[model samples]
Target chain A: MTRFAFTVEFDGRPFMGWQRQAHGPSVQQAIEDAIASVTSEAVAVHAAGRTDAGVHGIAMRAHADIAKEIAPFRLMEALNARLRPDPVAILACEAVADDWHARFSCTGRSYVYRIVNRRAPLTWENGLAWRVIQPLDAAAMHGAAQVLVGLHDFTTFRSVHCQSASPVKTLDRLSVEREGDRVSIHAAARSFLHHQVRSMVGCLAMVGMGRWSADDLRAALEARDRAALALNAPPDGLYFVRATYPGES
Target chain B: MTRFAFTVEFDGRPFMGWQRQAHGPSVQQAIEDAIASVTSEAVAVHAAGRTDAGVHGIAMRAHADIAKEIAPFRLMEALNARLRPDPVAILACEAVADDWHARFSCTGRSYVYRIVNRRAPLTWENGLAWRVIQPLDAAAMHGAAQVLVGLHDFTTFRSVHCQSASPVKTLDRLSVEREGDRVSIHAAARSFLHHQVRSMVGCLAMVGMGRWSADDLRAALEARDRAALALNAPPDGLYFVRATYPGES
Candidate 1:
């Protein structure tokens, strides 16, 4: 069996999430079904991160093992052809070492949350961004986001449904910036608890709207309690941007 | 009667264009109905530009005369409330002079065509942007675009159905830019013939894809015939960006 690493892009609006569910469709299920159609094997697909419903992926990394002989280009074209009618695309496919794991071998992950700071109702970007009618102070939000950087117990920012073993994780970076009427929050870490990025973005938005002070954010982190969380942002604006591996440049 | 100038935003995917149509819904009809619902008067709405079907608008300037005594804020809020279920919004509304006109008083108009230069299928920006799988040379397109940025009889770019009396119109600016995987074409003029912007964008795209040269573009313009047009871009990626008035900053 040969292991193939795939760079996938998808619109998360139609699926339940990345993981397979008994009730609804998923990104994983879509890809697995496509692979089965291509190779006639029901192989499991693993992703660098399992994004939630309504979230988006730019270059999400994944891996699957196949027994059939197939070129990377041919496999990518076939998979994309099979994944049609679904809002998913395989950006790239490459052969990797059989032992290389998509999740375990990942050294870093990055996410971005988009917010349109305008009173105008979203037209093109309806479910692609969070709309905040009130003006946002991006500079202030950036200043306050620094409080969440570095190693910390992120229990306040983690989801109650999160199945992680521990809440202590090292946050490499959290930055906020404004471009035109859009404010983007970018987060990078070795790994993250479920809903951590969205949770932090929600509180940062509160800070941007002058509803919370930077001290309030620091205090919330100190509380280390879910109840202390200010807000949990909707899944619409969140995107899994990229994942970094050890040897890949 | 108070002349209210509105800054409107809309997703044009659901309409038969900006004008009122006999057989289909339109942005104008939707807004007009909303205004009539609020004022109990069938007021006619006029726009700076009559954008074609599937063409989005960002801060599109429009005006309507209302005889009812209503505050600008209240009217805007009511209109927004009534425009629900449609991807349209009144971004801003303000009272203007009696003689102020949306179309005749407009001194400048600007449009943007978005092209996603990527191999992957678009998810979030599915119908909002044109996807070109081939690599585009934005710099070349920009260089060629300069050839059309002056006084000329733009018959080659104008549509056969254009109702303008004369084809001789001065184009203020035409620029092509690339940001990551997205290529944007910005066109500005005092006014434009029907399909002028789309026609120019299509030819420029051909230049970007290395199918045509700068000399070929100049020759097409000099030909001054609609038959000389290479392509007419679809309305999906076209957006009526802004309108400039004489005194507005």
Candidate 2:
């Protein structure tokens, strides 16, 4: 068997999420079905992250093992051709060691949340960004975001439905920036609890709008209670940007 | 009568074009119907440029003459409220001088064409950007674009059905820029003939792909014949970005 690593991009609007579900379609099912059609084998695909519904992916990494001897480029092209009319694409594909797993071999992940800080309702970016009518203080949001960086118990920022065994995780970076009416929040970490990025961004947005002070946010983190969460940003604005792997720049 | 100028944004995918059509929906019809619903008057809306179908607008300037005694903010808010579910928005609205016109008063216009130079098909940006599979030399495209800038009788670039009285128009600027996989072409001029920007971009793309040389582009312009046109780009990647008016910074 040969293992292949694929960098994938998807819109995440129509699917239920990355994981397969009995109720609705998913990105994983789409790819697996496409692979089955091409290789006649029901291969399961594994992704670095199982993004939520309506959350986009810029370069989500995944891996699948196949018994057929196929070139990586040919396999990618065939899968893409079979996945036509779907808002998913294989950006790059390469052979990987049999032991290299997409989920367990990743070292870091990064995400960006987009906010359109304007009164106008979104047109082109309707499902791609969050619209904040009131102006945002990006500088203030950035200053407050620093409090969430480094190792900490992120229970306040995790979803109640999260299945993680522990809430303690090391956040490598969190930054807020503004350009005209667009605000972007970037987060990087070794890993994240379910909905942690969205939850953190929600409170940062509150700080940006002056609804909550930086001290209030710091206090919420200390509380480590789900009820202490100020808000949970919608999935529409979140994007899984990239995943870093060992020995790869 | 009160002349209200509106800065509008829209995703043109669902519309036939910017102009009102007899058999299909148009951005003009949507906004006009919204205004009529708000103020019982069938007002005619005029835009700085009549963008084609599937082309987007960022800050398209438009104006309407209304007899109803309504504040600009109120009219804007009402229009937006009524334009629900449609991919259109009124970004800004204000009273303009009685004689100032959206079309005739416009001194300059600008457009940007987006291209994703990658092998992968687009996901979030599908129908919003043109995907070029081969590599592109943006620097070479920019160098060739300079040949089209300045006063020229661009019969080769104008559409056969273009309604402009004269083919002689000055192109103030044409620039190509690239950031990673994204390439943006910005064009600015006092005005443009129908399909002018798309035609220019098509030839520039050929230059980027090494299919045509800069001298070939210059010769095409000098030919000044409709048959000399190499290609006309699809409207999906084109965006009506801005309109400049007299005395407006």
Candidate 3:
């Protein structure tokens, strides 16, 4: 028996998300089927994050256990070959110890949300970015984001269906920057509540548009209710950038 | 009569090309329909470049004549409102002199071709970039590109069906650079023979991959025969970045 860790990239547009569902295709099912084709084994993959539909993954980490012995590079080649037309690929494969887990061993994660702040309807990036007709004050949005930092109960910014044991999560960083006509929001943390990043970005956008204030955000956090939060940003703009482990750099 | 000059942006994935065709939708037809909806006058748009299918446009310039007087900014908004779900938008509009033409008045044009040089199949930029699985040598590609700069008979790089009377074109700049796993080829010129940029990029990519040599490229250019060049690069990776006029900043 051997354990292998794989770095993956996916479009997420055609799948029903990362997890398998009865009704539609998923990134997980695609990889699992590819593994079955290559190794003739029913392998279940454990990912560091379960991204929503229409989201994108640049460097998602996952792990699988297989009964057959194969070279790491060959494993990558076989999986990629079998995963055709699905817009998913295994970037790297490395043998790991039994205790090495893609999810449990992850110490840090980062995500980026994109917004095209212009009037022209999205052409190339139609389903890949949040297109806003009105201009957003990115500096003001960045200023409001500072209020949400530190250890706190993020109940107001979590999805109602979130199954996390606790709402308390420390947000290590939340920064907003502008380049040309696009606004990008980067968030980093050890772990996050479900929909936490999207919810926070949605509220910050309001502040950037002058629809909400910094004090309004503080009040929403203190409310400690899911209903107090603004709308969740669309999944298209969210990207699971990377997962980090200790001494893995 | 009023003449309006507009800058447009489009995804270009669905259209046949920039010019109208009887068999399929084109960017010109979409814009013409949108213009007729707003002004109730039949207008024919003339663009600086007639881009091929699957080629995106960041800031394509066009000119049209309308019978009624309309503010440039308002016309842009009205046209955008009518473009529907075709992924086309008017970025900006301005009144121009009757003698001005979209194609004739352009002093310079720039294009960017994006190639993803990595093992992972493109997820985030699936349709936006061309995926090259092998590693590309950017410095080598850049070096080879320098040989094609300046005035020359570009028949070897022109499409066989190109209708231009003369094959002589001057390339102002042909630069290749890489950022992480992506390689970008930027081409600038006062004007280009049809399919010149894509042809050059196709050959340069071959050189970068070591499948062809710099000497082969020079021989192809000097041959002055259409059949001397390699295949034209796919339109999926091409973008008409912008068209610059004499007085515009």
Candidate 4:
């Protein structure tokens, strides 16, 4: 048996989440089914992060083991073919060391949240972005986000359903940038709590709208209480952008 | 009655094209229906250009006459509310002179055709780009495209269904640019014969793939016959990007 790692991309509109569920379709179930169709072996696909429903993935890292021998490129092509009509794609695949793990591999993860700040409604990007009708001050949002960078107790920014053992985690990077009517919030860390990025972004948006101040954001973090959270942005604009592993670029 | 000019945008995947069709749904019909729902008066909406099936519009200029008295902003908001569930939006709207015609008063038009030159199948961008599996040398395509710039009798590129009085027209700009796997071909002209941009792009792609030589392209243009046309690109990747007019930036 050999372990294979894959770079997967998917539009999350039709998916319930990244994990397998009995309620509805998930990205993991789709990949697992595709692998079964290709290799005749039911393999469990493990993703680096489990995204929420309606959360898109640009280059989500994942891995699975198979008894059948197949070239990496051929496996990727076959998986993509089998995953057709489901908006999931296997971009690249490579055989990995038997000890390598997609979830436990020591690495980093990055996410991006897209917001279309415009008076006009979205057309082609309807399900892909969050539209904020009020004018936003991106610079203010950026300033407020700086307070969340570095290690801290992020309970106020985490989901109640988070499975993490601790409420405190290191936030390596958090920044907000804007271009015209679109605002993008980029966050990176070794890992993150459930809904952490979306929660932080929601509070920052309030600051951008002149409803909250940077001090208010800092106080919310210090409160370390879930009720202190200002808002938890929807998963529509959230995207699992990238994941890094050892010895890889 | 006042003439209202609109800047429109839409995803072409769900519609037949930009114009009202007898058989299928269209962007024009969607807008006209929305306007009628708002004003309770049936009006004819005209566009700067009529796009083919599966062609998108980024900022297509169009105009219509509304007999009902309403503010331009109110009309735009109402139209958007009525256009819900459709992949169409009005980005901007304003009252214009009665003589300001969308088709006749236009000074220039621009289009961009997107080609994903990669081996991997598209997922999120499935219907938004034309996938070319072959490796494309974009520089070669750009060099070959320059030959078609300026005035020429583009009979080979003109569609048989084109109603233009003359196949002779001036191509203001034709350039090919590449960003990683995405290759965009931008074309501008005072006006274009039907299928001219798609036809030119198809041949340029042939040159890009090393299937046709630059000399062959010149020969095709020189032939001035529809029989010389090499290929007609699918409309899936084509987008009507801009329509320039007097006093508009």
lDDT tens readout by residue for model 4, A46-119: 99999999999999999999999999999989998899889998878999999999999948999999999987
Off by over 4 Å in 1: none
Show where candidate 2 strays beyond 4 Å. Answer: none
Q: How is the predicted docking of candidate 2 categorized under the CAPRI scheme?
A: high
Ranking by lDDT: 2, 1, 4, 3
Model 1, residue B98: displacement in angstroms? 0.9
TM-score of each: 0.98, 0.99, 0.96, 0.97
- In model 4, what is chain B's TM-score? 0.99
DockQ of all predictions against the true structure, Cα-based? 0.66, 0.87, 0.69, 0.79
Q: Which stretches of candidate 3 lie over 4 Å from their true place?
A: none
User: Candidate 4: lDDT of A209?
Assistant: 92
Identify the candidate with maximal TM-score.
Answer: 2
Write model 1 residue lDDT over B1-249, tens digit each, in one string. Answer: 899999999999999999999999999999999999999999999999999999999989999999999999999999998998899999999999999999999999999999999877767677788988889999999999999999999999999999999999999999999999889999999999999999999999999999999999999999999999999998889999999998999
On a 0 to 100 scale, what is the lDDT of residue B159 in model 4?
A: 95
Clashing pairs in 1: none
What's model 3's lDDT at B131? Answer: 85
User: After TM-score superposition, what is the CA distance of residue A17 in candidate 1 from its true location, in Å?
Assistant: 1.2
* CAPRI tier of model 4: medium
Model 3, span B1-249: residue lDDT tens: 888998999887898989999999999999999999998988899999999888889899999999988888888888988997888989899998999899999999999999999876666576788888767899999999988999999999999889999999899999999999889999999988889999999999998898878889999999999889877888889999999998889
